[model samples]
Target: MAFFLILFVLLLLLPDAYVWLSFVRGTSVLWSVLWWLPSGLALAALGAAAAGWFGNGLVRIFFFVLLCVAVPKLLFTVFSLLGRGIGTFVHGAAAAGHVAGIVVAVAACGAFLYGSLYGWKRLVVRQTDIVAADLPEAFDGYRIVQFSDLHVGTFGRDDRFVRALVERIVAAEPDMIVFTGDLVNASAAELDPHLRSLSRLRAPDGVYSVIGNHDYCEYGPHGSPDGAELDFEEVKRRQRELGWDVLLNESRTIRRGTDSLVLLGVENVSRPPFPSRGDLRKAMSGVGAGAFTILLSHDPSHWRREVLPETNVRLTLSGHTHAMQFRLGGFSPCGWVYSEWEGLYREGDRMLFVSSGAGGTAPFRLGAWPRIEVLTLRRGTR
Candidate 1:
C-alpha cells in the first residue's frame, strides 16, 4: 500500500511538472497550464479514493478516468523529453523539439483510443498440438477446448458476445472441454445471466472444471466469510446443474478400449498472499503410475511451485493472470509477474498451457484480446 502511494504521488506530479516546463520553454502559459487540469483532478480523485475518502464505486469511476488521462499524459511527457533532448543536440532549435513532441503525443493518444475501443472485442482462436508418447492410441487426436477467467459479472448485457463465444467453441467440435477456473468475478449470481450461453458448450467427453480463487467469493464486497462460503457452494451447484463435473481436489478416469487416462483436479493453489487450498497429492491418490495424466488447476504458479517437482502429471491447464488484460504485439505484463504466464510451456515430457482467458473483470483490453484455445493430443514420439 505504501509503495503504491509513493508511485501514485510521482505519477500525479510528473505530468503537471512537464506542463510547467513546457510553458517555461516558450509554449503558451495559459494553454500549457490548462492542459494539466484534467490529469491533476483525476489524480487527486484517485489518491482520495485510495486513501478511502470515497466509496469503491467512486474509486472505480475515478480510476477509469485517471487511466484515460494519465496514460496519454505520461506518454507525451516522456516522448517530449526525448524529442527535445535529440532536437537540441542535433539542430539546436526548440521548434524542432516541439514538432516532434506534438506528433508523438498524437500517435500515443490514437493508439490508446483504438486499443480501448476495439481490442477488447477482437476475439480469436488459438490452436496447438501436443504429442505424448504415453497417451493411448484411442485417445490420440483427442481435442480439448480450454477457456478460463470468465468474470461473468463484467459481461452485463453482453450476452450476444457470450453466445458468440460459445457458438465458436461448439463449432470447433472438441472431444473434451475444460474450464480452468474463474467463471465469475465475485458473486455466484454473476453467472446467472450467462448460463444459457455457457450451457451451449458441449463435447463428447464432457466438460470438467475446478474452482478459481475468485469463484470462492474471496473478492466479494458485500459478503462476510460465512456468507462467502454459501456463495462458493452456490457456484459449484450451478456448475453441476450445467452438466459440468466440478472437481474439488479429486480425480476421475476416462476409459478408451483397454487404456485409460487420469484426469485430476485440485482447487486453486498459489504461493501465500493468494489462497492455496488445492491438495495435489489427495487429488492424485489411488491413480496409476503408468497412465497419461492431465491436471486442472487455476493459477499457473502452482505448476512451478508444486506440480513440477511433486508429481508426474503430463499436462496442466490454468488461467489466473488474465495477462493483466493488456499486451503489445505478443508480449504481456503477466510475463513479468509469472514464469509461466500464458500459452504452452514445456519441460521435458511435461507441459503446461495457460490461457489468457476469455472474459475479464474489466471491459478494457489491448493486444491481449480474449481467446479460445484448442489443444489436440497426439500419441507419438517427443
Candidate 2:
C-alpha cells in the first residue's frame, strides 16, 4: 500500500514538476498553472480512494482511466522534454531523438482520446476461414460465429450498441454460434437486462457455451462457498433460458446426414488463481478418435498446458485474455504476457483462435478493439 501510495504521489506530481521547471525556463505561468490543475484533481481522486470514499468498482475504473491518460502523457512529455534538454548540450542525434519522441507522444495522446471516446463503442467483425483435412465432408462450408467476454455489467448504456452487434451477427448467417465464456461480469443477474437482445442470437446448429472464470462469481462481492455455487448454477440456468446449450466438461455430436463432428466445452480451466474445472478427457469421453473435435475453453493457456499434448481436438476457441484490451498493428503488450493473446495460432494439425473479445471490464479500449469473429470451416488441405 505504501509503495502504491508513493508511486501515485510521484505520478500526481511529476508533470507539475516538469511544468514548474518549464515556467522557470520562461514558459507562461498561466499555462503552467492550467497544466497543473489536472494533477490537483487526480491527487484528490487518489485521496478519496485512499480514504475509502469511493466504491471499489468505481475506484478501480477511475484509476484505470486515470492511469491510461496520465501515464502516456507523463512519459511522453517528460522524456521528450528531457531529450530536448539533452539536445542543448549534444548535437543532431539528440535533436532527432527529441523529434521522434514528440511525434510518438502526440500520437499516443491522440490514440488515447480516440480510443476512450470512440474505439470502445466501435465493433468490427473479423472473418477467418479455417481448413481442416480431417473435417467431415458433410460439415464443409460450416460457419460459426464466436463471441466472448460479454461482461454484461459493463454495458451501462450500450443497449443499442449491443443490439446492433446482434443484428450484424445474425446477418452473417452462421450455421452455429458459440460463446467461449464470460457472459457476465460476475453474476447471472448481470444478464437480465440484455436477455431479450441475447435471445435473438440464433443459429441452426444451435448456440453452445461454456463457463468462464467470471461466471462463477469468484471475483464478486464475498459470499459463502454455497452462495457462490448457487450463483454459478444460476448462470447456467440463465444461459439455457436464453436458448444456449451450456456444456460443462462435455461433448455433443453434430451430425450432418451420415457424417459427424464433435463439439466439446469444458468449464473454465486455467493455471492457478483461475479455476481449473475443465476436464478434457471427461469432456471428450464419448467421442470417437476419428471424429474431428472443436473445443471451447475460455483461457487459451489450456491449449498449450493440456489440450495439445493430451488430446486430438482439431480446433479450440478461447477468449479470456481480451488481449489486455490493447494492441498495435499485430503487436499486443498482452503478447508479452500471454503467448496466445489473440487471433489464430497453430501447432501441427491443431489450431486455437483467441478472440480479442466483445466486451470488457472497462468502458474504453485502445488498439485491441472489440471483435465479432466469423470462422468458416473448409475441408481438405489446411
Candidate 3:
C-alpha cells in the first residue's frame, strides 16, 4: 500500500503544479471552490486497498463489483507542459527546480508501478510434429500441453492475475494438460485462496502434476526455505484435494485408438538443487521401445545429462526455472539459475521444452508473464 500511495502522490501532485501554474491554474477564489485535493486523497486510499496494503485480499480484489472508472488526466497536465523543455539543454530545462524534481519523480514512479504490479504467466504451446518418421500413422498430429512451476505464494498471487490467467488457459484449448510440478508456493494455505480458480483447468486427459522444489517448503532438504510459509505434508495433502494426480516416480498410458503413449512422471528428486534418488530407469523399466514416450521430469538438465544419452526417451518436458522468472529478448534467465531455463533445446534426436512457469516466487515480475501451456503433440513416423 505504501507503494501505491507514493505512486498516486507522484501522479496527482506533479501534474497539479503544472496545471495550476498555467492559466488553467484557477484563481484563489475559483480553485478554492473545487475540493480537488480531498478527492485525490480519497482515491489514493482506494488504490492502497486494491494493492493489498490496507486490507485483506478479498477487500482488495476478487470481490469487487464496481467497474473501473476512468481517471482524470491528472498527471498529463504537468508532463505536457514539461515536454517542451525536454529537447533543450538540461540547465534551461525548467525555470523551477521543483518542476525538474517533479519530472524525475513522476517518471520513476510510473516505471515502478508498471514493474512491480505486473507478472508473467508462460503459456507453453508445444509443437511435436518434429519427427515425422517416429510418429505412428494412426496418431499423427497430436499435441500435449504441459505447464510447470506454478509457485502460488507471496510474490506470484492475486485473484485478478489468476482470473485473467484462467481466460488464457481456456483460449488455448489443449488436447491434454500436464502440470509438471511445483503447483503451490509452500503450503496448502498459500493455495487456499485460489483453489476454485485453478480447479477450472480443463483437458481431456486431465491435469496431471508432479512435485517440484518449493512444494516441500523445508520439510526435506530439497524444499524451499527462502521466505517459505508452508510445510511439505500440508502441500501434498492440499494437492490431492485440488484434483491433481501427484505422480511420484510413476508411469501411465494414454491410449488413442489401439496405440498408447507412455507418460512418465516423477518428483523433483532427480533435478539439480535436489538428490538423484529419482530412478528414470525404474520409471520406464517395463515400457516398450515400440510405445510413444513422454517423460515429465522436473528438470531439463535431467535430459541433457541422463535422460537423452544414457536413456532413450523420445521427448522430455520439465520446468523449474521460471526463465530466471525474468527475461527480455536476447537476455534469458539461464545465467541467473538453471542452465536449461527456458524453451526447446535438443540433445541428439531427443527434444526438451522447459517452460518459464505459470506463477512467480514474488509479487513482482518485471519481464516474464505467468504461464498456461498448450502442447500439441503431433505423432510422426520416426
For all predictions, the C-alpha RMSD in Å is: 3.2, 3.7, 9.7
TM value for model 3: 0.64
Off by over 4 Å in 2: 1-64, 91-104, 222-226
Give the alpha-carbon lDDT of every model.
0.81, 0.82, 0.62
What are the runs in model 1 whose C-alpha is more than 4 Å off?
20-67, 84-94, 223-225
Summarize candidate 3's per-residue lDDT along 233-322 as a digit string, tens digits: 767667677676677788888887887777888777554346444677778878887777788888777776788777677778888777
Residue range 1-382, candidate 1, lDDT tens digits: 6797779778866866785776544667777667767666666766575564543344444545555666666766776676667776777545655666567667766765665566667788999898888889999988999988887777765586788889989999998899999988778888877898888788988999998988987665553548878998999999998999999999989888888898999998987677778999999999988868999999999998888998999999999988887888778878888988888899999999999998776666677888899999999986
Write down the lDDT that model 3 would get. 0.62
| lDDT, candidate 3, at 38 | 42
Clashing pairs in 1: none
What are the per-residue Cα lDDT tens digits for candidate 2 across 137-246? 98889999999998887775448767877998999999999999998776677777788898999999999999999898765654565877888899999889989999
* Runs in model 3 lying further than 4 Å from the true structure: 1-113, 121-132, 155-157, 219-231, 270-277, 380-382
